[model samples]
Target chain A: MKVLAPIAAHEELEMLAAAGAEELYCGIVPREWLERYTGAVWLNRRSPKGGSLDSYAELKRLVDDAHKLHLPVFITLNSPYYTAEQIPLVLELAHKLSDEIGVDALIVTDINLLMRLSQEKLACELHVSSVAAVLNTEAIRFLLNFGPSRIILPRSVTLAEIATITRDVGQQVEIEVFMLNDGCAFEEGFCSTTHHHTVGAFCTSLSEMDTQFEWAGKSFTTRRQNWLRRNLTDYREWVWYVNGNGCGVTPKGLPYGPCGLCAVPDLQRMGVASLKIVGREASPFKKLASVKMVRDIVNRTRAGVPKLHVIERAKQLRESPEHCAAGFMCYYKVDESA
Target chain B: MEWSLHIGGAHELASELWLSRFVEADRSQLTQPWSELAGRLLVTEFGDIRFTHCAFGNEFCEHLIPSVSALQTALTAAQQQQLSFTLLTPYVSNEGIAALRPLFERLAGNGGGEVVFNDWGVLNLLRRDFPTLIPIQGRLLNKSLRDPRVTPMYATAPAPSSALNVLQRSNLDCESYAALLTGLGVQTVETDNLPQGNDLSFAQYGLRIATYAPFGFISTSRICMAAGLHYRKADKFQPGAPCRHECQTHLLEYSYTNSPFGNRDQKFFLKGNSYFYAHTESMLHALFAQIRAGQIARLTWQPRLPMTVAH
Candidate 1:
């Protein structure tokens, strides 16, 4: 398996590549788009503030530099869907990235955009974004008609489901799974809530809401309501911790969000092609640490380490035994019976 | 415009008392049953409408997919009521697809009914093998902005018009998208009555529009909170964990206090794995107007909050 890390700036290229990142992906929103759409109408799913490169020149430099290190860079245009008027501008940007900037592939989500790409036969490859929410093998087979070389599975899918999907279609298309950082409470593709910095994410704001419970058209007792409220609060907190405690990092310079290092053996055995490290908007240090940690685990797995020892080694790197014990930060559910 | 009553499972169809009331109720006086189900008076104007179709099946969770026997019960009820049957489906894993295939086969053999698909794979399945079944794009596939927080900001915020347009617009406005759906054998698309309002001008694309009322989904999750309401803390948030259908019995209402989006009294309802907001009276009035103008061809009414079977 290869390590696909997020790249934002040209300067972070050397550090990430040195940290064992074989592949790189980033989002770029042009100045012209910002002047018009003003970041609210995101060209990509990410906020344009720090999540994306703001100029084509910067993207060109980053792509060129990463290619020199034998690393292929992918660009994200993975908003859930694009309107008719926005399609022309998006296609223009896709063309420039594929033709001029020499990007390796375009990570896309919109079905219409994928159809357009397929129709135009763009030079670069098309990797279906997780935002497209291709959860089933039938969905993968359906998407195969569009000719995407890779499919990034969503965070909502379980390890068993991933194994099934890869087993069914892994031979036809490369399968990528989220291995580290930034987890979503809901399936990102099905989530239609806006993610602007102004309004924040819908799920994050849910934790602050007061609750009332009704069953069969009657209110629950105060004690029961309060108990359920606590449960709901705990659930929200768990979701927050799994989503990286608002993209938090630990004292040891390791990321504090969702981790799937223990599942590396399962993913590798299932013929998974790549392990994606999310967070294009993360700080440079967090990116490097994430890449290094995943690289070490992959190396251990490749060296024929026992699966149990590899799982323990991965848990030790987090420096948070309580979270690992609770399985609060697990991206893929670990089978205890195993 | 036509009307359709959407229920979640076979139990709702088995209620002879409810079925009789729904069939014989006067259009102008039909709001009482819906209001009683919602715990509040939801729709005020029915405008001499009558339900001509009955839609069953869950759109958010694959676990809630109706079994083969349930599908038979729903089809029998629809036939007895002289209404067309529409089968609803959710985004599924390979297992979900497998579970739905038998139901699809039943529907197909029953002489073809309308099937609403929320996932592209399901649509592909229908087009490929179950070609006899009619495909309607489910509301979940209608990716438009339905966030309640941002809906209120559309009037007060000083954001650019283009930014707001992005919020108010949806794939329906795209000709290519409409063409794609039409190419895939879809003639009607389902959408929510968004609080920010909708532009149904896309009806010119020769595609009919079906809008759901009273409740619009804000978001859905595979990490079902309702399913784990009784589980231990360590196992509470596990994705794809088995459940006892706790969502069918409990309904949660969330109200924001000291909300940063101002004092709009934002309230959301959590049912099953989805969060929804009740449509305002003004939004319903606009929807009625749209129906009158012939822009909306169908109104799918959700009497209950989650559109699930009564407990």
Candidate 2:
């Protein structure tokens, strides 16, 4: 399995590759683009601190370094959608990444951009980012019109569902799965709220506070309102409802690293081309650790480790044994007991 | 200019109000001139295409998605009622797309209804498999960043020019973007009554525009607090966790405490699986002027109704 890791700079390239990153991806924000939109309207999903390369020259250097290591670099242009005004600049960046930088691929979600890239006939392969929300074969078939070479599946699907998709469309293009890090409680493409808060994404913070629920009628309000108010302390349960697991740095929380390492054997058997580890904004230390962990799993599974032994190893890698105990932290649901 | 009424389903807007039955089904029935309305937008399931407050995790939600039979029956009934139909769809997974293929094909077979697609996949499917179905861009895909935090800023005197520009610029405001969508077989687009307001200049771009009045969707999430209420534990607060359709049972109001500009005091309505806010009468009237001037060709009247959760 190709371990795709997030890249922020040339400095992290060698370490990432040495840590077993076979492929790399990052976002670029040129000075002109930043001056216009600022960090508020991110050209890509990551916030300003979300690991965007400052200049095209920096990106080109990163690409060159990855090429020396014989690794391909994919650029993320995968914001949910871009405005028409933003498209020309975005396309310019796409062409530069393809021809000038010699990047292997451009990860995109906007169909307008996808159609433009196809029409423009850029050099690099187009990768449908999970932001496009390609959840089904029909969605895949839809993306096929633009001719993407790889599709990074969203973190939301279960292993069974992933198996079904790979079986049906796996042969058509390279299928990628979220092998490690950053799982959203909600679907990425459909989420419209700005994730630009300095603390964390506002969507992820829904469970942290209480919001008053009001409506038009009296009896309706009285019954529903009083019941909800009475359960103010229990509202923490509701927070968990919004966040799939509670928000914490611990393994038990929903915002915690939702790892799919346990499901690697099945994913490989199903012909998944790559396992993605999200964390472009994370520290190099964290990125290196993630890469090492997934790389180790890839090495073991490829060397034909027994399922039982691999399962035991994966349990140790998790935040806590109980993190996967309920099968919630498993990026892809595995049938094995924790 | 045209005016159409949008309802969740026949359950909400029956042929006649079922006064004897229950309030949920009876209270908000369309009558009078609306009965003869030329177009009716029936949401079979809140389009998975949009971010809804309730999510069943992945694209396909057993609890949230409506069945093919239900959609077909609704379409046929709409036809009998002499109301033109526009099928609204959500962002979905391959399974959800596969599930809806028959329905898309059926729509094609049934004289090709207008399909309002929030997901590009649905649009692509229409182009490939069901070409005859007229495709309109749904409001969800009309992604103009509407952060409620900025509403108070717009209300303030000397509002920041940059924020104003961002607010005023609709995704369709760029002529080329509208042209691109037009090239993709979408001639019509739907929009929310945004507080920052819309620059309907896209009308000059040769696209027909529609807007939902008095209930602009600020944003939505699959991590629906409403769905979470039914879950006994945080671990159980996931998709396919045996929901009892708590969204239909109740509505929640959310307010932010640390909001800048006292924006937290603004109450956003959480109904079913989505967050919505009512537009002011003045806002509606101003938009009505645009409709009269033909900038916006259609106005979709969405009457507030009790949550009617469906299959």
Question: Which ranges of candidate 2 are over 4 A from the true structure?
Answer: A198-200, A213-256, A326-328, B11-62, B67-81, B105-110, B151-167, B170-177, B221-225, B228-235, B240-242, B305-311
- DockQ, prediction 1: 0.55
> What C-alpha lDDT values do all the predictions have?
0.82, 0.66
Best by DockQ: 1
* CA RMSD of all predictions: 3.1, 6.5
Runs of candidate 1 exceeding 4 Å displacement: A336-338, B8-46, B155-158, B307-311
Error of 2 at B4 (Å): 1.7
Q: After superposition, how far is residue B265 of candidate 2 from its true place, in Å?
A: 1.3
True contacts kept of 2: 0.38
Best by TM-score: 1
Location of the lowest summed lDDT over 10 successive residues in candidate 2 chain B = B47-56
| Candidate 2 TM-score to native | 0.84
